[model samples]
Target: MEIFIVVLILLLSIVISNILSRLIPFVPVPLIQITFGIILGVLPTGIHMPLEPELFMVLFIAPLLYNDGKMTSREELWKIKSPVFLMSFGLVLATVLIVGYIIHFMIPDIPLSASFALAAILSPTDAVAVSSLSERIHLPEKIMTLLEGEALTNDASGLVAFKFAIAATVTGVFSFANAALSFFVIAVGGFLVGAVLALIIARLTAFIRRLGLEDATFHVLMQIISPFVIYLVSEELGLSGILAVVSGGIVYSLQSDYSEPIISKLKFVSRSTWSVLIFIINGLVFLILGLQIPDVMSVIFRDDTISNFKVLMYIVVISIVLILLRFIWVYSLWNEKWSVNESIEENPNRFLNSLLTSLAGVRGAITLAGAFSIPFYLENGQYFPQRDIIIFISAGVILLTIFIASFVLPLLVKNKNIEADKNSSKLNQQALKSVMNAAIRLINDETNQENKLAASSLINVCEKIKNDNPIDKEDIKLTIEDRKIEKDIFLLGIRAERKEVRRLLSDNKIPPATYEKIDNSLTKVENCLSKPPIIETLNRMDSIKNFISKFLKKQLNVNPINIKDIKKIKVLTSKAAIYAIKEQINDTNKKASLAVIDHYNDIIRRLTTFTIGEDINNVNKQRSKLHLKALQAERDQVQSLLQNNEINRETALKLRNFINYMEATAIEEQSF
Candidate 1:
């Protein structure tokens, strides 16, 4: 019942925090939530929520850190690796030693062991908190990256140091050699375990994908299981779970092909879900911090046995010292030239940015959990020294930092506009568009010419036959000379059209849509022209006609014509061609129609390449006109052949009719 009530309150707080976040964008939501928690904690109802520090760390901190690590750009991380590592690991160790000593010496009432534990708990910065704050501010990417990276990496170091300190105190022994050796083994061993596990998981996932399983389910399961497995396994093996989780996250990210369709979809879903969870966790932690304020005050004030003023003074002093110590430590590194910026102002601002990174260090769940987890007493009945005082101080520092960092730091920095690297990106996009447009134009033009020539040849062959002559099938055959001439003319037209489209594309007059429509029509024509003309295969003729209709629909931007419409046109054309061929008709209509169809296809292709508003150069339009001339020449050849009886009149009529169909289709399609 207690657990359920706590959870309900946490949920309710999250809802309220989200609403408040929007209303007050300048103040962070976490800070607001923690303030709320502090208020709740002081209530007479005694609404205290207990969360085991270890469990909370694993469930919330681990995933949040893992995500921060993943999103950090690889190049930026590597560039600042030295400073990041130093700040996270070296500074954490320094903070523990320095602060622990100060607390012990300045306040004799606090035990050395307890001081060190408190210092250790406070050593590591919260990556989740830092990252959240960074996003809200206009901090430089490199600065944000350094802070987040340091926070993430230092948590493990700080935890390890804290454990060693605790062990030394409990066992009444301190050995530098053993502690150093243990740290080495735990860090190295945890990393190795995480790496191996990550590799194995990557391979297994790839295998699963190959087996044709649904990608969504597999990816979701991977997200749910990977972190826990890594942490638990490493800990069970007597290695650092923090190191293990970090190692696993890095290795898994490097190894996995997140570009795969399933993985991509899963990533989107996981990111959205994880973002909310982390927010609520941080919100609840902070809100609870706020709720504890009244209780903390009640304990100190009501219990006159303890000096409330002195305690408050000590907390203020320690918090100031902690904040100052960070600035001093950061300043010491100034002489080292850690970054490209040589100017003192620039370098220090970078350092300052890191210092103020996530000011809302509201020591929420972790501080509370760690403070509460203090060993009650030895069997001899000796009490822990200043345990409650340490808790109060830690909580105080968290509240102080959260408020100052979120509200104060923004005032310190000068505001400036920051823009993305747009010049390079713009150039790249333009280059890509140009190349694609060129390729499209080239293909469209060539196909168009081929269609026109085939039409002309068919018309010519039909005109050469006579209807009244004795049905001598051998005479019906198209002469080699005639076939060769037709093929040459068709090939020439295609070449001319290709050149013209290229010119128009260069000029930037033809729009992409215009090019696409013409290209599609040409593609259909090419397919039809590839096969020999066969009267029995009326379906093929239907297909060719359908292509023409589709081309027209595209040009006119009209609703698509159905297959039935295509079939009807094919039947009509095929019947006319057949009648002309059987009667040896002298119309030579087939040859003319074929030629026109070929020319029309070429024109459409050119139009598609010539981006209407784009090509100001007039190059593409001029080239298109040249190809049109070539088409005209072929049309004239078909006319000559028909007049000379090389094609019968019926065939000529059929060719003319086909040409009309091609013209109308191309015109309509081009309009679209």
Candidate 2:
């Protein structure tokens, strides 16, 4: 029960942090989450979330590394293997030797081995944190790749070095030759074990398929658990569990058939699952660090030998040294002499790239976890020297580095070319337009009139298809015949909206959360449309009650719309509506169908006739105005139908609600 409460609290903190992040977009999410954690620590609830290093390794670190390994581009990794090795292994070793000595020299009370241990743990950068930060700023491709590759490989190397240092400290003995041999065996043995296990699992999957036991959920579950299994097995055999998981993930990636339809379906589920899992784990890691920090600080303050200002200065100095050493190392790798065979010497961004790399090498929970793992006592039954201080310094460095990078990286990135971004945006718009055109053309080519009409009605709702001329408010004079046609369109439109949202989800164009929101809205509208008038009224009442309940509990925040994409969808939908209406004109009430055709034709005219030279903001404004007019016209038609006794109360009410929803969506889009 205690464990459950702690888990619940951590999850709640993550939710709050996400909400705050959306509200305050300027601050990086990791920083906001850490701040929340700090607030939790300062609360008087006396919450103490203990950091269990081994458990943390298995639960969080293993899966994270596995996912990173699988997702990281194999081609990019191969292209930059030399630099990756330099950063992951060489830089880590150098940091340990140089920073370790400097730390001991600065704080003579800390034994040399303990100092090295601190440096070793801090050497590994948190790529997850850096990746989150990089989302706001466009990082150079090579720099991003190198950072990811280094982060993937360095965690294991850093942890291994840390363990060796810890051993030396506990036993009061050190052997370079023995340690070197053990490191080689540990790293190699881990990779071999991981690779073999992955191969075995692949074969096992084939065997299951042959036995006709093909379940996507079962396969995904196995994949999920494989990292933990490989880590445990490797650790049991005294190999590097971190390396094992990484290698296993890479091996699994290599063996998987991505082109297969079944694999594509599974990828969708797997991607979502891993995304959520990583998010929660990453959040909990930072929050738990925040929880542990208060106790670590109190312990540091209890030491009368060190002043608070001096301890802070120590953290500042150590952080600077780490960054300086990393910059020097990365800069050396970027030098003309170092790149004699490579064309990288001519790249003008080398200095900034090196600086970015150095700044990006911020330490995270791994450092604190390793620090927490430090032995409490040495061989002589005396306390390990300055253990609490080491943890405090580690915690301090994590916060300071993240805070510095949050501010500094963006300033550095501001110098990046604006034209490149504009060109990219232009290309995206063109691609979206092309996709919309192709979808319409596909519908136009359909031979069966009924099939085309059905598809057209759906495309109309989903794409918000508009025609050339804006219908006058007085133009809509619904007869019973017109009402029946409009009812068919409305019912079909609801179904189409649901289908299109699903298609967008499957295509990975919109996120699942966005899909869920739009689907829920459409579902409620559908329920109201399908029910009897009394039930429909009751349903509306229930909806209002639920809305109030939600308002009192959680704020409903909708995702922002891309006006360009919405406009493209509308254009395609209009074309579809025109094609379907022309087909129907030959079979249905000619006058009523013509009026509907005129309504859509007016939409197309407004959408297509807008000045091409206008700025995007002007265009968006014009489009929003047009959309609102269209929505109001729709509401007017529904009202006309009700007055003519064409649609009953339930149908009229549902149509009005649907129009209201669309108008609300358009208004929200205008803000963006």
Q: In lDDT terms, which candidate is top? A: 2
Alpha-carbon error at 523 in model 2, in Å? 14
lDDT of 1 at 649: 34
- Worst 10 contiguous positions by lDDT, candidate 1: 468-477
Quality of model 1 by C-alpha lDDT:
0.57
Model 1 CA deviation exceeding 4 Å by range: 1-6, 44-46, 257-262, 288-298, 335-365, 379-381, 415-672
Q: Please write out the lDDT profile of model 1 over residues 1-672, one tens digit for every residue.
A: 988987888789878876776578688776877777766776677577554676766777666555555555567688888888778778888889999999888788877876788888778776656655553453444555566677667777777787777665666577889988988888789878877876787777778778876566566677657777777788889887777777777776776545464454455456556556656766665666566666666667787788888888887888787777777776676433343322112334445553554342323345555665666563345766676787778777776766677777566532311122223223223322332233233223333453444334323422332231112122322222233333334433333444444455567745444445444443444333333324215534755886897788789897543333322333333333333333432344345335434444444454445544423223333333333333333344344333222332333333333332233333233223
Most accurate candidate by TM-score: 2
Candidate 1 at 155: error in angstroms?
1.0
- What's each prediction's TM-score? 0.59, 0.68
List, residue by residue over 136-163, the lDDT tens digit for candidate 2. 5445556767888898888888999999
In order, candidate lDDTs are 0.57, 0.70
